[model samples]
Target: MPMLTDTIKEKLSSIQGLVFTEINNYPCIEVPKEKILEVAKKLRDECEIDQIRDVVGVDRFTKNDRFECIYNLYSHPLKIRIFLRVKLDSKNPEVESLCPVWSGANWMEREVYDMFGIIFLSHTDLRRIYMMDEYQYYPLRKDYPLMGLPGAVQLPKK
Candidate 1:
């Protein structure tokens, strides 16, 4: 994949509170949670990022701001991809929804919410994608029990 052009780098750098860096040769931006929406908008409008490949959640189980959200974006025209990483508080993992900028982010965001318990604010239909609506536990968190929570959800008998 091609790296971000100097012009693109300049544009991205203009966004306040964004740290531009590269991971495995692909451009990655560390964005503050409060500036996520603004950065997403700039990427779409000014950078021509047309697709959001995926939204991934990470659980760094230690202390202080343990949750993170990584948004994988692709610019079809530029043939380049970039990652937007945002850290969230472990106590309340919530961030603005990118669905407003990329409609395709809907299900991706929901999946992150479903598995990681990270809430996407203003998401059109933020609900459990795999688990039942009443399900309380997030199965993918590092702290989740290996065997699963007892009586959290009853299985159907054959």
Candidate 2:
């Protein structure tokens, strides 16, 4: 698998706005937010990545771009998995939706948005899936209180 990883790294390195890194020995690619849709199209059309296993959002408040949207993709025929990441500015964490590339990403992107407040551009329905519509804050951020906020304890109005 290392050979395949190296080959993929070599192939993707030439793509503009792509930066490669390794996590737990697995190759991960970082792409500019504006180029994510183009990159996803390439990964799906050319690399046989058929499944988007997961979409995760991370908030590292100390970093320059405090938010990251991560995608885990799998190719069953190739028997390989790949990670793609896009760093987003803390002030406006928004990126183009991948649901166009992978239909399964619709709900996954909503979940990330609900938890991390990251907006998905061009998503058919970008709304809170887990939390109520009136919920005001993203719960997964590091700054959120452990127990609950003052207003969070109030029961929803009937």
Candidate 3:
């Protein structure tokens, strides 16, 4: 099978509201948060991207946007990988949920929400998957305390 080529990249870039770019040598496309669901549906149906491999969040504390959410997708038949990124502001970071596109995204989106405090708008059951319901801080943030915060649960006494 042929690998993802320039022609394919150009086709993706040609999508009305998407930008093809790269990050750390990996080909990436930035999709406006509002358009993520639409673009994701197209990629799944047209490109045969069968799986959402992972969803990750980066905390760029110093940057004005402050966070980036990345979606890693794989096309099983074509043997290709694509990365979709969405930049979000630090305060009240939120993006449309992908659960409607791929059911597997339910847990992945919840994980991102748990660690990064980003809301998946319209998610049927958005909640903390790992952290406690009352935990106040996003532990993965660059500004979170290294020693853990006061009043939150501490390590169990040995």
Best-fitting candidate, scored by TM-score: 1
Q: In what order do the candidates fall by lDDT, top score first?
A: 1, 2, 3
**Backbone clash tally (model 3):** 0
lDDT of 2 at 129: 96
lDDT of 1 by residue, 16-132 (tens): 787877879888889999999998898899989999999989999969889999999999998888899999988989999999899999999999999999999999899999999
Of candidate 2, the 10-residue stretch with the lowest lDDT total is 5-14
lDDT of 3 by residue, 24-96 (tens): 6667888888888888887888778889999998889965789889999888998778799999987779999
lDDT of 2 by residue, 75-149 (tens): 898988889999999888899999999999999999999999999999999999999898898999999987869
Q: Please provide TM-scores, in order, for all candidate models, with all chains considered together.
A: 0.93, 0.91, 0.87
| Residue pairs with backbone overlap in model 3 | none
In angstroms, the error of model 3 at 77 is 0.6
Candidate RMSDs in order: 1.9, 1.8, 3.0
